[model samples]
Target: MAHGDITHIDIPVSDMARATAFYSGLFGWNIAEMPGFEGYPMWQAPNNISGGGLAPRDDGFEQPRSYVEVDSIDDTIVAAEAAGGSVARAKAPITETSAWAVIVDPDGNHIGLFEGVVGG
Candidate 1:
């Protein structure tokens, strides 16, 4: 992941099974639910590009958003705030090696920030 690279994406779906079937069928994606993240199934595209999560359509997360990889989640959130963006979600650990955060741009579009696996 690079500083400005679009590293991941997340799509909200009303029906997990239905949405999973549709996307996997249409794009030949391989989606599976991880043990800890049971309800939020992650997907990988055929070309091996990693992006997105099929999240339930609740809690004002009914839209699709892309994540940009950053070297520092805290620094990026600060910069986003300085640039008139607001934090949607604070930086949180996804795993021992990774973390992510969400922010809303000046125009009100949601953007996700990902700090990829650290010190792996």
Candidate 2:
């Protein structure tokens, strides 16, 4: 499968409101509350070059991880596994069109693969 650029990042926060306010006030970012994303508040930068959302961690995800963009998350996961990597989070659909997954590289480095859909 073809590869895409890393389009977004996800930040794990214990307090969504606090994190949102901090980033918004500090960097003057436009942070919005997106209920459609399972209460994950999203932060969008002014230039729109870099952005991500804040999700509450409940599954032992103590640290935040960076997400890498790819054409097909399944293919990336397969390649990662073949390269002696492990799947931290299986491929899961974010919406009808987009999908994402977390995997550990050969060196146990956490990496995220994100696939953006046309309408997502």
Candidate 3:
């Protein structure tokens, strides 16, 4: 994804099986667990252009979190802070060429930021 694109959306769930069945049944999404990402099942929309993971619910992740593609995590973090948002999570490595982080908006919404091919 290019800058400003919502790369992925993570929907927090309490019961994996129930949530998976509900979403897959209602949305006709292809939900399945990947090899490396077992407990968290991934769902792909029928269009194949939209997809995200059903994450296990946890503190600060009780609601759906959308990850946006950014040009640089460092710059975004700084910009977010300057814009009244605060860093919820510092930049973390996803792979050799990719990274991700989270920021809390003024309204307390936690949005994710990703850079590179992690969401591709």
Itemize residue pairs with steric clashes in candidate 3.
none
lDDT of each: 0.88, 0.80, 0.92
Instruction: List residue ranges in candidate 1 displaced over 4 A.
Output: 118-120
Write model 2 residue lDDT over 83-117, tens digit each, in one string.
Answer: 89999988888878888889998787788888877
Instruction: Answer with 1 or 2, whichever has the higher TM-score.
Output: 1
TM-score of each: 0.90, 0.87, 0.93
Q: Tens digits of per-residue lDDT for model 1 on 22-110?
A: 99999898999877788999999988877568988878687898988899999999988999999998999988889999999999998
| Clashes (candidate 2) | 0
Q: State candidate 3's TM-score.
A: 0.93
1-120 per-residue lDDT for model 3 (tens digits): 689999899999999999999999999999999876779899999999899999999987898999999999999999999999999999999777788899999999899999998534
> Which residue segments of model 3 deviate by more than 4 Å?
none
Ranking, TM-score, top scorer first = 3, 1, 2
Winning model by lDDT: 3
What lDDT score goes with residue 50 in model 2? Answer: 78
Q: What is the lDDT of residue 41 in candidate 1?
A: 96
Q: lDDT of model 2 at residue 33?
A: 69
